[model samples]
Target: MTSTQRTSFPRQGVRETAIAVKTRFQSASDVLSDCLEEIARCEDKIHAFNLVLDNQARQRASEIDDLIARGIDPGPLAGVPVALKDNICTREIATTCSSKMLERWIPPYNATVVAKLQDAGAVIVGKTNMDEFAMGSSTENSAFGPTRNPCNLDYVPGGSSGGSAASVAAGFVCCALGSDTGGSIRQPASLCGVVGVKPTYGRVSRYGLIAFASSLDQIGPLCVNVGDAALICEVIGGYDPRDSTSIDEPFSGLLDSCDKGVDGIRVGVVTELLAPASPDVQAAFTKCTDKLAAIGAKVDEISIPELSYGLAAYYLIAPAEASSNLARYDGVRYGLRVAGQDVESMMRATRSAGFGPEVKRRIMLGTYALSSGYYDAYYGQAQRVRTLITKAFGRAYESFDVLLSPTSPTVAFGFGAKQDPLDMYNSDIATIASNLAGHPAMSVPFGLGANNLPVGVQVMAPTLGEAVMFQVGAQIEGLAQ
Candidate 1:
């Protein structure tokens, strides 16, 4: 059927329909096809999708149609189109993490997050690109190439979840899943002008996601709006027996809190974040704070002195964990293999040849940090700093219901502008502390910046305090509108 004709068909959630036959007015196939067509139209410019599951998506749509015809409910997200970060496993799709090492590997099983989305009747539209092993701040580090910012092609979409953010920003999908180890999700969402949430660590199971830093990694929703993010989180979150770190606590009323409003809420503006941000970002944040005050929220400045050390500490700790977690991909066990005379040589050659420059840089830094001579100087010191930062957050949370900061220090930059590795790493400075503290944080589009690109205001709450985060985020979202 023609794209125009298919789009004209009546639509229902994938799970809502039970018949396989396409109706005169509407069908699941129609909705899926239209979305696919939209993706085709813009994906070239955005470079968001790594692999488009055209056939598989069509088949799922047909199945949903049959189910609806049978009068069976497909469930909340049934047939809804959702894109997944390439780092997240999908049965036969290549979950590359935008790295050469796993370029040809297909996961044998779906990740926990992917499974939940599937159960909800969501169609996997495609795998989105990301920084190799989720190690960099810009999508330019991806083996596949960078994902362009939808708002301005010359600028970035943010990373390591850059592709996922761009896909949603470009309207390629209603929502997408991105893994955030240290600001990956929130940074990109902010850059792309979309809603992105980084759930408290352990809130979402990390079973099949390619590990960056196991302790800090989280899978969350990137969507067009806060409500969409909340909806997707409801479907993918909750305890998982398979993930030991997964909290056993019942699902928190995250969605319900969205409508609760932020009246009488205590919002803390971190003074450290304000000083370093560009004037535009600072102004945007100030305007947001004013809006909160107008809405009856008590806005106050709170200090987290230790947060200034977050970026340095996170770089050390995350890479240390990542070096260990990624060690398993040696030539013999799995992934790309390099033939050599001995086992050691084979493993060395494979890794050296497969991993991207950014990944290698991190692995080397991590190895050096964890190495015998420097362990105390690097990794140990970073851990101690982390403890201090965490404590500072704890103290701040005690005084304030939520903490607010500009999601990024600056607006999106040109793809390769931050060529210096250290410069790129610093891009995550403002958003990394929440990851260290394992708190729920979200990025909401607050206003336009110097380049006319979107600027985001990040709202963070104490551990497992997503309900409060949502309330504050919803308030900010309302103000932005």
Candidate 2:
């Protein structure tokens, strides 16, 4: 038997696009041109990117075509176009984290994952907008502007990885990179109707990712399909000497596992996580689990009460880390310096002028939590709760190969729907537990909910369980079709 010979460029999907370009069935330049054309057509309305690398992407595409002409393989991602969440450093490219503080800051080096993408022949399209310092659940916190959901322009794409998910949903790129802190990646992927992966905390290197919450952040892929997400994860995952937290393990065969299905696997539906979901989302989740069971998987409902504490713990821990990480942005160093009489006043003025409301709110919350008398009551307690959640998840995994839940409690809501900060924070409830547990999790678009907006069903696995996670995600994706 022989594989099908492609004669035209694949309109989507990372694997097909890369194979089509690498096998000489499609030109890298042509693929890039199509992406650029799409960007020009709708980017104004979508506002998905902070900066689009038109010339650089064109030049890179040409270089890949040249490599293929010379009979050298350009690597797996051959000519697939990819977007990066602005928080991921890209050497000379400005990495703003969608915040005014670092609006003009350019790194001297690329993130480990960025370099990996280039090595895999993925063209760099642009940097996508995100919540200011990944502090919000909606892209509305962006200093530049909010990214609207591609599924329905009136609604928001979830954040702080909103723009990355929007880019994939809008067909601006084959896939995009997003850093998941709390529910940044998965929640947005759910809202945007795309596939988003949050690999085990250390499964992918965080060396060049501008830290929001050092311990909770993980860089992952936002793609149109599970297969593309798996391929990108495989390309970017594995040990990195530069990242102290990077897992010392080889990451491969993930793409191969996509077709393996979930037959005979033990799947658990997290009861507490599902309790808060909207009826529409609950319905979609029910369908997702039923599909899994019908496919020969052993599916059952399981309660992990400790997950209820995840939201409170994440808020305290992530912000405490953010308060420390963002300290370098003071006027004494670089970016958005506000003039004042002295260094002390200048630093205060600069932070006041540079940070958005949401960023300031989190910073204050973090500072207060870490303050002299409150550390034990707030930050320390949060860390203890994190340990509890991690242990609870470990115990659940002992009985189930994977856990299931709705990625977000509701479908993408209209802009300004969650003006109150607490309301905004609640959006991440279902997804935060995975970040807390340092486990692998993914959100695969299951079906539509209220107003025909997309709903995502989350598949979570124990640490280093990406292969099984992808397998279940693929099965759910198949059901959606």
- Highest TM-score: which candidate? 2
What's model 1's lDDT at 467? 88
Worst 10 residues of 2 by lDDT: 1-10
Stretches of candidate 2 off by over 4 Å are 1-11
List model 1 lDDT by residue over 278-298, tens digit each: 999899989999999998999
TM-score of each: 0.94, 0.97
Sliding window of 10 residues with minimal summed lDDT for model 1 = 4-13
Flag regions of model 1 displaced more than 4 Å.
1-26
Clashes of 2: 0
What is the per-residue lDDT of model 2 for residues 148-193, given as tens digits with 9 covering 90 to 100? 7777788899999999998988888999999999889999999988
Error of 1 at 408 (Å): 0.5
What's the true lDDT of residue 416 in model 2? 93
Q: What is the C-alpha RMSD of each candidate to the true structure, in Å?
A: 4.2, 4.8
